[model samples]
Target: MMWRKVKKFFSALGPGLVTGASDDDPSGIATYSQAGAKYGLATLWTVIITFPLMAAIQEMCARIGLVTSVGLTTTLKKHYPRPVLYLMILFSVPAIILNIGADIASMGAVANLLFPSVAPIWFSLVFTALLLIVIIFLPYAKFVNVLKYLCLVLLLYIIVPFLTRPDWSEVLHHLFLPRITADREQIGMLVAILGTTISPYLFFWQTNMVAEDVKVIRKQVMVNKRMIIVAGNEADPRAREKRVMGLLLQKMGLDVNLGMLLSNVIMFFIILTAGTALFPKGVRNIETVEQAAQALRPVAGDLSYLLFAAGVIGTGALAIPVLGGCLSYIVSEALGWKGDLDKKFDRAKGFYGVIIVALLLGLLINYLGISPVQALLYTALLYGVTSPVIIAIILHLANNKKIMGEHTNSRWSNFLGGITLILMTLSAVLLVYFQFFNRS
Candidate 1:
């Protein structure tokens, strides 16, 4: 009975787990590693603060998908004015592509660190090709399973910190006590961490994947998809359907909370590994995943370095598809093109084409004399600046009774969502001011 329950629990986890694991992609790892390397445990509190907010917002996104049976972009295009939808696409596409580029480059750099013979560019090309083939050719179910298993790769991060045996007292102190400041560098790092954690692309991906899952369920179990009737006098036929939907949403909440919790826990461990392993040794700045791994060799031993490097590749593989798929979903939905991972490429040409083009552009970014880690940081900054707008939109969508029916945001959801909005908005404003005005 216990084994069956454990198996069922794992089986129920889906998009949320993938999304959460992808949240700590190589780019995110670089951000967290940079945080720890630069400020030691000072930045640890951000993880603590972001957990509930991330879980709350992601649950909203998942609920939107389940209720509407559509992606966020589709809902936006259908309900909002054209400019609002277009403006979001305009800001989102560039940042997401850059994110894909950064992850691809980081994977290649780390691969080179593991094996010094081949150059990073060659590794980047090979990985790009591999990802392209995997995304385009694999069936959606297989692809999702692949991602779910890849999430296990992140366990390496949790293990690495312990290998160095960090000071538990200091770690707990920093985890609980918030250490923030007005310093430009520290604030910038904080914003990067926030941006990496509460990303906008994630909102679209989560909603769309849930919508897709509903589509799958509708096919596999047809009776569960019906909603309410409009005639005032008519008796409702959706009582059983409503129960099924309720069960689905409950499962989704469990999936999302667990996923986000895992994401942040891995995030915390990465920071701890970097802080304990590199910070005290005066390794202050980490610009790449490779640099972070390399710095671990002398201080944290070879096993730590090897695990860090391996985790980079695993997370890059896990995350790039999500980045590519999200961009495709946004474009396809906005343009009214057919798109789904389960569909053959010929059937979803425009959707798959957008993904292809994005990956190619991302691959091209590596040759432009830009540092992959630096680009990752800047991508996080861009995400930080633009996410508040997206978060506000998500909040509006979640609360709109017309959209959600009786499933609108609960009081606690509203409270957490509101706080997320305010906090992200302030962080964006501060980042902009610091970047443009306080450059002295």
Candidate 2:
């Protein structure tokens, strides 16, 4: 019975888990490492704050997909004006490209750092090609399984921190206490943390993947049944809808909470590892994931450095594709091009075309000479600025009962999502001001 239950649980894990794991991609790994190395657990509270907000907003995205059988952009077009939709695409796609570019470059940089003989550029091109081909050709079910294995890389962070032997008492204190600051640099790091943690790519990816999940299941698993009308055909249609929605919501809730919680827990551990290993040694600043790993060697141990290096490569491999897919979903949906990842490349030519274009554009960033970790921070800043707008749209759409029917957000969902919006908005505003006006 227990084995069956466990099998069922893993089977239910889908876009939520992928989204959560991708949240801690190399960009986040770099950000969290900086927080730890520079501040020494001082920023641990961020994970505490972000986990619930991330989960709530993601749930709304998932719910939108489940109820409407469409991605967020499709839902946006349904309810909003064409101009509004185009403007959003204009604002977000560039940000997504910047992010994907940075992620691709960083992934290559980390891979190069691990094996100096293999050039990072080669890694970047190869990774991009592999992701594009796999995502375009592979069946949806198989692709989800591949992503699930990538999630295991995130577990490295959880284990690596123990090698540093951090001060648990101090780590716990910082983890619980909210640290408010007016220091410009600290504020910048805080914004990066928030932005990278609950990012715009994730918002797009989660909604689209949920729709894909429904599509795959209906077309493949439930070959003889139409899931959309499954509830309506029941004896008590109203109750049946509620029951079906409840099951989906419950499963999604479990998947999302587990994924987000894991993401933040990994965040906490990364900070702890950095703080314990690098902060006291005055090796605070790091420009690449390689540097962080190298810095930890003498301070933490050789094993710690290896694990850190391995983690940077693993998570990068996991995340770079997600950044690509997120943009692909948005672009295809906005243009009314066929946009299902589960379809063959020939079948969804425009959709895969956008993905290829995005990845190819991302390659140009590597030749521009920006350090990989620095580029990651810049992307986080972009995410910080762009995500609030997306989140606001998500919240607005999630609350509209006309779009969601009876599946609109619960009061607690609204409350938590509200907190996320306000917090991200404040950080984004401060980041903008600091960059343009307060740069003294």
Candidate 3:
């Protein structure tokens, strides 16, 4: 019975796990590491606060997909004004491609740390090409499962934090109690962490994946009902009702809320790991994931270093595909092209073409001699600025009765989402203030 339950649980896990794991991409790792190294637990409070906000936003995205059977872009294109949809995608696609470039660079940096002789540029190009091939050719189900397993590498962060033997009382105090030092560098790092944690790609990916899952569910349900009808007597209404209810329960058992909670818990541990391992050592400067991994060496030993490196590489692999695929989804939706991973490449020519172009462009960006660290920072700032518009559209779509039907966001969801929108608004304000005003 226990084994059966475990199998069932594994079978049900998909969109939530993938979205959560993608949150810890190499750039995100750098942001979290910088937060810990710069202010220790001072910025740790944001992690706890952002958990529910992440869930609320993602849940709305999921709800939009499940109810509308359309991706966010597609829905926006149909329901919202064209100008609004175009404006959102205009900011979103380039930002996503830039992020892919950063992840590629970060992955190469990790590989270079391990090998020391491999050139970062060569490794980045090779990695990007390999990722594009895998995502473009591989079956969608297989690609998703591969990403789920890659998430296991994140456990290294969990283990590394414990090995550091951080002061528990101090960790708790800093986490629950906020601190502000009035330092610009510290404030900048805080904003970066917030931007990284609550990203826009996750929003697009989560909604589209949810739509994909619903498509699968709907197909399975139709097939199952046909099978049951054939197996039962034609006049047996009771048997038909029983079969339908069983299917409903099976679908509901996925417990999406619970999955979101588990994902947020993993995120909390990541922030905790960085807070404990790098924060107290006065290592204030970090521009790369490799640096964060190396910082774990003396404090958490060789195993920790290996673990951090593995996490970076694995998460990078998981995220690069989603980043590429998201751009594909947005463009396809904008241009009125059919887009679904379940559909064959030949059937969705424009969709697959967009994915290929985005991936290739991302790969080319690495060879352009741009510093990946600066690219990552710029990506964060870009997403920070663009997130408010996306959030506004999402809230408006999710609340529209014509789109979500009965699955429109609940009162509580709207309340939380409104609050999240406000928080993002403030973060964007601070980001602009620092970027332009404070720079002088």
> Which structure among the candidates has the greatest TM-score?
1
* Native-structure RMSD, model 3: 3.4
Give the lDDT of residue 343 in candidate 2. Answer: 80
Per-residue lDDT for 433 in model 3? 89
List runs of model 3 lying over 4 Å from the truth: 1-7, 226-263
How many clashes show up per model? 0, 0, 0
| Candidate 1, residue 186: lDDT | 93
Q: What is the lDDT of residue 297 in candidate 1?
A: 98
RMSD of each: 3.4, 2.5, 3.4
On a 0 to 100 scale, what is the lDDT of residue 5 in model 3? Answer: 78
TM-scores across all candidates? Answer: 0.94, 0.93, 0.90
**Candidate 3 local lDDT, residue 53:** 82
lDDT of 2 by residue, 70-139 (tens): 8988888888888878877776787777767777777777677778999989998997888777777778
For 91-111, candidate 3 gives per-residue lDDT tens digits of 788888888888888888898
Q: What is the C-alpha lDDT of each candidate?
A: 0.90, 0.81, 0.77
